[model samples]
Structure formats: structure tokens, C-alpha cells
Target: MTTQGENIAERIKAQAVSLGFAACGIARADAAPRTADRLAQWLSEGCHGDMIWMEERAGQRGAPQALWPEVRSVIMLGMSYAPSRDPLALERACDIGRISSYAQGQDYHDVVKKGLKALARWLVEEAGGELKVFVDTAPVMEKPLAEAAGLGWQGKHSNLVSRDHGSWLFLGAIYTTLELQTDRQGQDRCGSCDACQRACPTNAFPAPYRVDARRCISYLTIEHKGIIPEEFRAAIGNRIYGCDDCLAVCPWNKFASSAAVNKAFLARAELVAPKLADILDLDDAAFRTVFAGSPIKRIGRNRMVRNAAIAAGNSGNGAYREQLERLASDDSDVVRDSALWALQRLSDG
Candidate 1:
């Protein structure tokens, strides 16, 4: 015989699936000890780089009750955005830009938030109780909570790796006063597989369990505010925003998220292997128009062009020489500096 709570949990899971989320489960709000310790050490080492928020809210992160004391239960959820195309093959082509799987469509934050809010509304209307839903926007330790809820286990990359969906799922959480039935906690299945670490182009993982963001290509290219170091320029390939090498290299991805987002994420005509020369020609208006909904829009034109300048230098295609020279004179100091660096590299070759 099922209790009222069990029925609610099952209905919630059913509605969550109906809403397009790939998986859902519930866990009692609790301290994520392992996640907490790692985050503490990472902050202690100052590895988060320019993201000061990671330090500012260190106390709230991974601490369920710290964010909201009444959080008796945590509902973990995932929405899959795995695109069916080859992100790797697209990188080498050098004509199309590669966007991370999550950035391809409408921001997952908006999509998931709407769904979570609806679920929370439903929970209140039917199940009755106070509840709060958070997409990745919160300090809540979503991955660990997802693990605790039996949705998945954290891979060596420390991202949640789901058995059914692979690592291609985006996670969100609902902190509630409801004492829901709990799912079994997941166990680490990464066992002896260092594929995620070995695949990093920047060697971001200082150790199997830790990622030093300073050494990560995604950090340098997207998150880091200043000039990219010369040593890593060539290795960055044509990846204009975020590198997928680590996530894509994970062997488990082959089994689970073996799909891709539709044409929205499919390398846009201009983005895929676009010539560095073509990108350098864009003015500010063009930049906004081109990547309107894309995450690349966040970096603005200066930084992106600066990155393009690096690609131009690495291009070795003498045809782009004039284009590189034009960017070498870009109004922004950052852009000119990168253009100059690429010009020198190209000239030397």
C-alpha cells in the first residue's frame, strides 16, 4: 500500500517528465560533506579565479539549510539538451564556432525555471506545503543533491553523470518543507577511469577529484577577464567560446546523451568554422545580431574579436593576413594586443 507522500512523489516525477525534464528524484536536505570540503579547499587555494562570488557565498553553497532552514526535502531534476551532432569534428573544421551544448538553445535557466515554478505551484496546490525551486542560478549544491537523490553520481570531472542520460543533462533543485520519500543515494562509478582528466586540453584538473579553474580552457577563454597567455593560444583551436574537450571525451557520453540540439545549436552558418577574417570584420551591431541568444553574447565583441585575432594568427592562412592587420588596429586595446600577437605568430611562420 502506498502512502500519500509516495503518491505525491510519483506524480511529481511523472509531471516532471511530462514537462521535458529527463529525470527527477527527491532527497532529504542534508550537508554535502565531500562537496563542501572540496569547495572549501578550492576557495582556500584561490582556484576559482575572477569569480569572486564563489568566495563571497562560500558558506551558502553546498549547504542546503544555510540557504533556507525549512528545507526538509530536496527535489533534484535534470533536463537533457544533448545535441546529436559531433562537437569535436566541428572544432577541427575551423570554419564553424562550437557552442557548449547548454548554450545552443534558449538558456536552460529560463526553461528549467519555468518548469520548476510550475512544479512548485503544483506541489503546493495538490501536495500542500512551502517549496522553493532553484535553477543553476542559486548557491545550492545541485550536483551533489542530484547525487543524493539517486539521479546520478558525480564523475571524476565532478559534474553529475547520470546512468540513463549520461553527462548531457542540466540539473535544478526544489527545496521544500515537505517530508517526501527519499531516493537511494548514488555511488561513484567512475572507477579507474581517468578519461575526463586526460582529455582536458588545458590540463585543468590538478588531481582526479579537483579542477583548477585557472588552468581550464573554458575559464581562460570565457571566464578569465584578461589576455590569454601565449602558450595556450595555439591549443585553443577555433573554439570561440567554452571548450568541450573534457565533457565530450567522457566515455559515458557515448552511451547516454548521444543527441544534439536542433539547428539552433547546429553551428550557425556564420559560426561554424567561420573564417577569422570574416569575424574580424564585424562591428558591434553585427556582434549583437549574430549571437543574440547565444552565451557568446555575454563576452561582447572586444573579447571575442581578441580571441578571433588569436585564431587568425594561428590560422597560418596567409589569406587572412590583411584581416589580421585590420584587427591589429582595432579600437579596443585588448583586441589590438591579441591581433598584434597573432600577426607576429603568423608573420614568423
Candidate 2:
């Protein structure tokens, strides 16, 4: 016979599914294993790079309960954003810019947080519990909590990978004061696969299950707020917003379903293999207008143009020389520098 708490958990999960979550599981708020020491070690190694916020919030990020003492249960939810086609398909097409699949559509933080709020409200009505919803913005260690909730295990790429959803999940968490039955933890299914590591264009991973964020294309493009280091510019290729090479190369993705349950995750027609020349044309107004609801807008016009300049340089197409030359005197120093480099690369070729 199921206990009352188990029955309530089942009902809450069912409600989450109805609210469009791909999967939902409960975990004890304090279930994170080695939560503090591991984070301390990663920060100590300086793997987090320019993302100083991670270091600042290291104490609270170490565990969920530490952030919110009253939280008895954490409801972890997964929403799938699986692409309709191969993520690696556009990698070789130099003229077109490649966006990581997650940023190719509407911003997931908005979409996932909306669903999280709805679920939290429903929980309040059904169980009368104090709840706080969080997406990626919080100090919570969502990946570990998701693993503890049986949603998925952190893969070799240091991302949550589900047997059902692969690595295509956007995670959301709801911390509740109500006691809830916890699910069994997901086991590490990655026995021996280095495909994700081998596929990294810059070898961002120094060892298994570890990533040097300083060398990661995603961090360099989106998070690092300065001129991207020239050493990794060539390897950055056409990826503008983020790089999906590690996630795309996971063998476990073979089990991933093609269709996305959330329409918000589906790629916008313009973002799918956008031309470098076109992206180079986006001014501040045009950039904001084009990516108003997309995650790409967060990087701002200068960074986007900077990334486009790098892509244009790697294109090996002399046709974009004029565009590169025009941007050589751009207002932003990073853009001007990147554009000058692109012009030189093209000139040398």
C-alpha cells in the first residue's frame, strides 16, 4: 500500500506532467552527495573561469537545504528540448553560423520558470505548502538534485543526461516545506564512453566528469564579457551563442526522441543555420528585435557581432572581407579587435 506522502507525490508528479514537464521527481532537500567539498575543489581549481558568481555563491550552491533551511523536499522537473535533426549537421558549413540548440528558440529560462511557477501554485492549492520556485538563476545545484531525484545522472560532460530524455533537458526546481516521498537516485549509466570528450573542439574537459569553463566555447561566447582569447578563436568555429559539441556527441543521445514537448524549445527558422553575413548586419536595434525572446539577446549586439566576426574569419570566404572591414572600426573594442583579426585572417588567406 502506498503511503499518503507517496500518493501525494504521485499526484503532484502527474500534475507536473499535465503542466508540460517531461519528467518530475522528488528528492530530499539535503540529498546532495559530497555537495560542499566537490564544489570547493572545482572552484579551487579555477575551473569556473570568469564566472565569479559561482565562487561567490559557493556556500549556498553546495546544497539546496543550505540555501533554504525550511525546505524539506525538492521537486525536480525536466523539460525536453531535443532537436528535430542532427546538431552536428551544420558544423562543417562555415558560411552559416551555428547556435547551440538550446538557444535556437525562445529563452528556456522564461519558459521553464513559467511552468515552475504554475506547478508551485498547484502544489500550494493541493497540499498547502510553503514553496519557492527556481530555474537556473538560483544558487541551487540543480544537476546534482536532479540526479538525486532519479531524473538523470550527471554524464561525463558534467551535464544531466536522462535515459528517456538524453542531455536535452532544461531543469527547474521547487523547494517545499511539506514532507514528500523521495525517489531513488539515478545510477551512473556512462560506463565507458569518451565520445563527448573526443568531440570537444577545444578539449574543454581535462579529465572525465570535469570541465575547464575558461576553455569552453559556451562560456567564452556567452559568459566571458571581453574579447575572446585568440588562441581558441579558430577552434570556436561558427558557434556564436553556445557550443553543443560535447552534448551532441553523447552516445546516449541515440535514445533521444526527436520531437520536443515544449513548442518553445523548437528552433526559430531564422536561427537555424543563420548566415554569418546576415548576423554581421544586426545593429543594436535589429539585434534586440531579432532576439527579443531568445537567449541570444542576453549576449548583446557587440558580443554577437564579435562572434560573427570570428565566424566570418573562419569562413574562408573572401566575400565577407568587406563586412569584416566595415566592422574593423566598430564602437565596441572587442568587436573592433575581432573584426580587425578577421580582416587580417581573410587578407592572409
Candidate 3:
């Protein structure tokens, strides 16, 4: 005989699938007890780099009940954004900028949150419970929660890796007052494979499951505010928006198919491999216009141009020298600084 809670859980998952969620799993509010301590340690070590928000809500982020006392269960959902082509294919194209697969399409924050709210409404009608939804904006430790909900385990790269979706799942959570049946926790299957660690251009992974975000190309390009450290600039190469080296190298991706990816996450043609010259030419207005409705818009023109300058320098193409010279006198200090460095690099060669 099946319990009422089990039936509700199954219905909730089916509803999530109908709403375009690639995966859905549930766990008790306090499923992952160690999440708090691990997060505390990671925060204490400054592994989050310049993202001060993580420290602001540390307590609430680690424990779901701490954030919402009424919450009894957590429902984790994943939307697959698996790339159609090799993410690292643009590496040899020195004059082109490689945008991370996730940001190449519509902003995931909007896409994932829309689905979450829809699912929350369906649950309210079906099970009659108070609920709250969250995406990456919240201080929530989504990967750990996903693991506790049996979606996948946090892999050696410190990213949730699904046997079915690989490392390309966009996570969202629904904390509810409903006491639903919970799923078993996901188990680690990484074994002795260290492919993710070996693929990092900047050695971002300090150990099997710990990532020092300070050394991560994605952090440097998108999160870190001021100038990027000199040591990692060359290693960043043509990747201006974000880096996917670690995620792309995971062996589990063999099971991920582009067919399973949501249409909202498909790569935009212009962003797949944009020319460095065009990116460097973007002023504030141009950048806003070009990236409208895209996640890359949040970084703004200054950071984007600064990143393009660095990639231009690494390109070793003399054709970019004039653009770099013009950008050297740009208004933003970071953009000017990066442009000057690129000019110097070109002059040296």
C-alpha cells in the first residue's frame, strides 16, 4: 500500500516535469546536516572571492528552516542546459571570445524562477501549502540541497553532477510547509577520476571537492570587481563571460544529450563564439542593446570590455592594436588598465 505522502510526492514530480523541469527530488528540511559546517568552512576560507553576499546570510543559507521556520520539506528542481557542441571548441580561435554555455541564451535566473513559481502554484492547488521559491539569487546552497534531494552529488569539481544531465543543470528550490515523502540522498560516484581538476586553466580546485573561487576563471571574469590578477589573465585566454573547462571534462557528460536540454537554454548564434574585435567596441549603450535579456548584461560594459581587452592581448593579433590604443584612454579605470596592458603586450610582440 502506498502512503498519501508518497502519492503527493509523485504527483508533484510529475507536475514539475510537465512544467519543463528536467529533474525533481525532495528532501526533509534538515536533510543535509553537514551543509552548515561545510559552508561555514568554505566561507571562512574566503573561497567565495568578492561575493560578500554569501557571508551576509550564512546562517539562513546553510539551514532551510532557519530561513523559513514553517518549511518542512525542500523540493529541488533542475533544468538541463547541456551544450550542443563542445564548450571548449573555441579555445584555438584566438580572435574570438567564448561565452559560457549557460549565459549564451536567456538569463537563467528569469527562466528557472518562472518555472519554480509555476510549480509552487500547482503545489498550492494540489497539496494546499505555503511555499517560497528561490534560484541563485538567494544565499541558498543549492548544490548541497540538490544532493540531499537525490538529484545528484556534488562532484570533484564542487558542482552538482547528475548521471543523467551531467554538470549542466540549473538548480532551483521550493521550501514548503507540506510534509511530503523525501527521496534518498544522492551518493558520490566520482571514484578516482580527477578529470575536472586537471582541466582547470587556473587550478581553481584546491582538492577533490573544494574550489578556491579566487583562482577560478569564471569568478575572475564575472564576479570579481576591480582588476583581474595578472597571474590568471593569460590562462583566461578567449573566455570573456565565464569558463566551462572543469564542467566540460567530467566523464559523466557522456550521458548528457543536447536533445534533453530545454529550448530556453539553447546557445544564441552571436554569443556562441563572438569576435573579440566586436566585443571590444561595445560602449555602455551598445553593450546594453546587444545583451538585452541575456545574463551577460548584468556585468555591464566596463567589465565586458575589460575582459575583451585581456583576450585581445592574448590573441597576439596586431590588428587589435588600434582598438586597444583607443580603449587605453577609456573612462573606466579597469577598462583603461586592461587596454593599456593589451597595448603593452602587443608592443612587446
Candidate 4:
């Protein structure tokens, strides 16, 4: 008694699960009025930081149909990268560096996008419709669409929070012309709890569900191309790649499915607690080799070294003086400046 659309939708969900997605749902492709409004407000407030692309493609990002008019249904998928242990264990591991759990393995963009493309291929073969798959690269408002599709709700930290997988989900979206059945939207369950906001090292959250990237450790370390402000340098601590305090402190993460179930997200031993000295010594070629398939590779050597220098300064160990001194002459002005600042902090200790 099922309609063709219902049958196709059911099969697609099954296929997505088989393809390693932790959760899958469908939503009608339409303009997201609320998301668009919030994006406009966020942009107007200059909260996007150096991510100019967020402004450049605002129209396409605001509405799914604007990116592809033929799209009738959006297939939303969630891949769990939940960590097996506490992500904050290294908070005081001064001599060692910490990488975000999500970035501790092969880039999720490649892994999740591969699954999305496979699902898209299956949909085309079975349903005979045009489709497009996106995994973070495009101007797609993936989190909003994922929530609309019932995969999860956007938590207070502005990231998707899944009941089954917690805050450690990697999101992907597929747009298709097929008129698929849509799922009911997920409800906001974050009522009253503000653990994520209070946990921020830099107080990056201007308010619940709003973030100021200019003061965000993730943005300062990964996106900003200049010297990090002295004000935030100490609070940055040893997080060299990305910040995880907000996500780690979320009460929802207690329900996170283990890493064994999410094989692709297993933490690499090398990234777990990399020696700051070793990282500070990496040149361009060494940096590429170390982060070959990791998300940290995107920032390249200068930025990674720059972040490492900041961590060294905050270490207060004073043992890293030689390494920090060497970096004081790094070719990149930003790295050189950070290294000089780090040397001063170490000297004053």
C-alpha cells in the first residue's frame, strides 16, 4: 500500500545506514526562513570572522532551492565521530598538544562525502533523478537542514546535538529531484542547560546559540591569518588545532555512541598527545607528512607552528625555550611573531 516515493525513501534510509551513516532523514527542500534570518543577523553583527565565503554565497546558503531549484527533497545524514574517552583529558597536559576529537583522524569531509556520493549514485540508479551531495564545502546550511529532517537539533553551542550520538556528529546533505517522504523535525531539548557556554575557554559564546568567532579559539588558531591577540593566548592553552571545551562539557555527550561503533572516527595515537617540542620543530615538508590525511593539514605548517608556539608559551614549563627560540626566526611573519611572544612568556616565568 506504499507509494513509490515512500518506498524509495525507505530504501534510501536503509542504504544510508549500510553506507555507515549513523542517522538519516529527509526534508522538503524549501527556503529556511528562520535560518536565513539568523544568518543575516549573524553576518550583520560580523560574527563570521574571516570566513568571507559565508557572506559571498549568503543567498545560496540561506535557501536550499536557491542552490538547486529542481531539488524537491533533501536527504540529511549524520555520521558519528564520538570519542571513546573524555576529550578534555589533556586540558592540563602542558608538555603535550591536544587536537579536537573530530580532527584526530582522517578528515570527516572525505569520509562522509564518500558515503554521500555513494548514496547519491544509488538514488540515481533506482529512482532516476538528478542529485547533488555536499559535505561542508558548499554554502549549504547543513545543520539547519539536518534539524529540519529530524536527525538532530542545533544545541546552545550552535552545532547539531543528536540524542543517539551527542555533539560528535559529522553532517552531510543530498539534494534530489525525487519527491521523497520527509521526517518530522526534531525538538529543541537543550532547555535551561548552559554548560556549553560556561565551558568556553575564551568566552566565545556571546549568548546562547550565538558565537563570536573573533574570540573563538577554533577560529583564532585555524582561520585567522595574523598574530593571535595576547589577551586570548594564555586561555588557548595547549589546543593547537581546534577547541573542544564546549562540545566536551555538553551533558548530551554522555549518551555518545562509542568510537568502536564509529570506526572511521577512531583517534590516532600520534595526534592524541603529540609532543609540543616535536610539533614546534616541523617544517613545511614535515608538517604535510605528519598531517597527511588529517584535517589539520588544511592550515599547513605556518599556522600549526604558530598554534604550537602559543601552546608552548602557555605551558609555563620553560623547558621548551630552545624550540620556541628557534621558531622566533620562522619564515612566516605570523609564526615568527607568535614564537617571539612565546619566548617572552617563557622567559618571564
Query: Each model's TM-score?
Result: 0.92, 0.98, 0.98, 0.98
Candidate 4: stretches off by over 4 Å: none
**Residue 172 displacement (Å), model 3:** 0.3
lDDT of 3 by residue, 100-129 (tens): 999999999999999999999988988797
- Candidate 3 local lDDT, residue 104: 93
Clashing residue pairs, backbone N/CA/C < 3 A, model 3: none
* Model 3 C-alpha lDDT versus the unseen true structure: 0.93
Q: What would the per-residue lDDT of candidate 2 be over residues 252-325, giving only the tens digit for each residue?
A: 78788765458888899999988899899889999999888998898899999999999999888899988888
- Identify the runs in model 2 with alpha carbons over 4 angstroms from their true place: none
For all candidates in order, the CA lDDT equals: 0.78, 0.90, 0.93, 0.89
- Residue 5 error, candidate 4, Å: 1.2
Ranking by lDDT: 3, 2, 4, 1
The residue-level lDDT of candidate 4 at 123 comes to: 88
Model 2 poorest 10 in a row by lDDT = 252-261
Q: How close is candidate 3 to the true structure, as a TM-score?
A: 0.98
The number of clashing residue pairs in each candidate reads 16, 0, 0, 0
lDDT of 2: 0.90
Model 4 Cα displacement at 73 (Å)? Answer: 0.6
lDDT of 1 by residue, 13-75 (tens): 999877777799888888356767878889999889888888888888958888888988899
Q: Which candidate ranks first by TM-score, i.e. highest? A: 3
Q: Is 1 or 3 the stronger prediction by lDDT?
A: 3
